[model samples]
Target: MDLNSGAGSLDQFEGGDATVRGAAVVSTRLSQPTDEWFLEPLSEIRIGATEFSEPDQKLFSVTQFVTAAGRKFSVPYAVATRPARGRRLWRAKVPAAAASS
Candidate 1:
């Protein structure tokens, strides 16, 4: 299913059977408005413990711009932080292609 296509889009396949072993799932309609689109980060991200060593610091950032129902929403630098890093280390900016297909 296309994640970008919102809700009712999957209604068409509601009564379909799982007979086909390798058939692709198809949706009837898109959940979101056609005009509405997502502007996601097409680049790499990098976050290390050094960047969040301080008690209060920006750990990560995100930018998103989408238009829905004739209204526009812009999110710039959605910053987040935590008191301290846990044993589970995290890394950002890793090439997505390298990690997954």
Candidate 2:
């Protein structure tokens, strides 16, 4: 997915599997997959010092899913880094606070 050129750019990945590099403002609810869990986009994201006008990348992470009723689950998945291009960066831990937010 091609991210928009604004703060909400990263937020666009709320329900999708993608990893966005650069200086990202990680979501408070990043570990959750529920409708209520949303990500706030970053003001700027870049590789090195070069701004990403349009980036194609991916991220890999082990994610944990929790049901509204309190059941929990985990899975490994790859998210597009720049949206529709690039390879995935791997992640291991999903913060508990992030999951419940």
Candidate 3:
């Protein structure tokens, strides 16, 4: 468990016994082995971003995820899910002002 050491060279182990040198942060034998990681297909995609008109200040309720790729869609806040990195995709109740966008 010498984590301070650099990464291990798994490439040295070709196809034979590759399962023994699999990836695991903890020390434990896996009942079910797997060589692939991305097993599930992505359901929804995060193409772009959305911004509401300041949520109408006192008129609107909570923030929401209602826009993507410049198109508006009604997705409840609770059930909304999107993967965005840094400032690429942002969701907010307020209109996408220069500060946020």
TM-score winner between 2 and 3, please give it.
Answer: 2
* Better by lDDT, candidate 3 or 1: 1
Residue 15 shift from truth in candidate 2, angstroms: 11
Per-residue lDDT tens digits for candidate 1, residues 1-101, read: 34333212322333355221122123234587645644432221111212231464455322222222223222223244543221211112445897796
Best by lDDT: 2
Tell me each candidate's TM-score: 0.16, 0.20, 0.16
Which segments of candidate 2 are over 4 A away from where they belong? 1-60, 78-101
Show model 1 residue runs off by greater than 4 Å: 1-35, 49-101
Predicted candidate 3 versus true structure: per-residue lDDT over 41-81, tens digit per residue? 11122222333334532221112222323432222122114
Residue 84, candidate 2: C-alpha displacement in angstroms:
24
| Candidate 3 ranges with C-alpha deviation above 4 Å | 1-6, 27-101
Q: Candidate 1 overall Cα lDDT vs. reference?
A: 0.30
Q: What C-alpha lDDT values do all the predictions have?
A: 0.30, 0.35, 0.28
Each candidate: RMSD? 14.4, 14.5, 19.4
Please give me the total number of clashing residue pairs in predicted model 2.
Answer: 11
